[model samples]
Target: MKKAVGIDLGGTYIKAGLVDENGKIIKKQQFPTLAEKNDREIVLTQIEKSIEFAFEDNIEGIGVGTPGVVDDEGIVYEAPNLPCWDKINLKKIFEEKFKKKVVVENDVNTIAWGEYLFGAGKGSKTMICITLGTGLGGGIVKDGKLLRGGKYSAVEIGHIPIDYKGPKCKCGNIGCIERFVGRDYIVERAIKGIREGKKTKIYELVNGDLDKITPKTISDAYNLGDEFAESIWIDVGICLGAMFSGLVNLLNPDTIIIGGGISQAGKILFDTIEKTIKERAMKILSRDLKVVPAGLGIDAGIVSAGALIFQE
Candidate 1:
């Protein structure tokens, strides 16, 4: 069985694993990214350490999933939280260090490929996957291939604008879907309701500390039978579904996979997204569409990173 070292690089931690070709993780561990130091070399050393931790003599190579826009040659651009990361040739760096073949891709794109191969999207001809959390990231698998641009990982789905005149996103785009559904924005909605005295359990869950309110708090409130909390997830789902409706029209994907922290809202969120997409997208395109949770679970990143190298 062929194996590889997989590295999932994040702002706060680097998750490393030894994975077989079948997408099963044989062993895995986590290391702090130490991105707070804001030194590129420090972060690089951390990644190297992660690679070493997972490396084995018989492994085929290393696969890295990093947060950034990665070009065809594995040159990373616009990496957030990692200082001086722009224009770094990650593939070249790691290959030289480890003396092995290396494959690097944007983290979300890696996840989409993993789902396509071993998770919810396994049997689908076309699939779209997104991770909803502090920020929204997405990838697409079309016709049994991971979609990519001519020279870069181009499926930047989160940056797609839903409203050109609405609030500006952190990416400098106005009214991107992420601006309305990202973590802070979701929490902002709950804060507004509390300030307006809407009388909900969210306030109680946070003990009046508006700053402490999170999507989890809202989920907890909804579990306690709070209608107001349910409203927040519904609105978020609507925002996401509205964006996905456009994607469905353009891509005609058969499956849409949702993951990451906020996806834990479970039934209410998924149901609302499916309902809204059905209502908004073209009937022919939306009819067979299935919105499902990601199948890779908590270790998706590590497994997906390995999948990058094991692609058929």
Candidate 2:
């Protein structure tokens, strides 16, 4: 079978995998990206090492998924989290060394493409794929194709304004969906509640350490019958639903896939979002659109990167 090498580069970790042309991952490995503590050369070295771990003589091509604004030719203009990844010609660098066809794209787009070709979105013609983690990232597939705009920076669904008068966003906007539902935002909400003396299981789990009140702690609290934790998750769900309601009214996608670590809150989180979408979205769109969690689990990054080649 034809083989390929795929890389998923993130702020915290870099995952590399060997995949068959059929979209099945044959082998996978990871390394700490240390994107912040390291310079461009160091990070590139880490990537090189990961590729070495997964490399085989017969690999046909290489595909990389980066969390940044990547041009069609695999140049990264900027990575939001990794400060050193500015204006890097990742494709040229890797191809010069590996002598293989290399393609690079935004991480979210890779995830969406993986789903489109091999996972939950396999049959959908139009879909919205979201990953809720340190921040929200999204990719839109319209009419069975990735919607890359003129500058390869379209469908950044997370930056959409949810509350015009709310907090300032990193992108210089006010009250983006990420501002409401991102992991840091969620933790901040929990911290605010703790400071205000709103008691929950989160405090016990974190042992009164406010900084330790993570999303998992909150989800755990909700699972353990803490009303305060439930409220927090529900609030984020409402924000997500409200935002998607607007998306449904505008783009009318057939499926919406939610992934990333934060989405593991399971029923408590999903139920509220689904309820809000059904109540607020266009009737036809809500009735027809299927909103669900991702199917690729932790393998998404590698599989999705591999998909950039197969789907092309």
Question: TM-score, each model?
Answer: 0.98, 0.95
Tell me the lDDT of model 1 at 117.
87
- Model 2, 200-284: lDDT tens digits are 8899999998877789999989989999999999999999999999998988888999999999988877888889999999898
**How do the residues 98-117 of candidate 1 rate in per-residue lDDT, one tens digit apiece?**
99999999999999999998
Regions of model 1 farther than 4 Å from truth: none
Q: Which stretches of candidate 2 lie over 4 Å from their true place?
A: none
Cα lDDT for residue 272, candidate 2: 85
lDDT of each: 0.93, 0.88
lDDT of 2: 0.88
In candidate 1, which residue pairs clash?
none
Candidate number achieving the greatest lDDT relative to the actual structure:
1
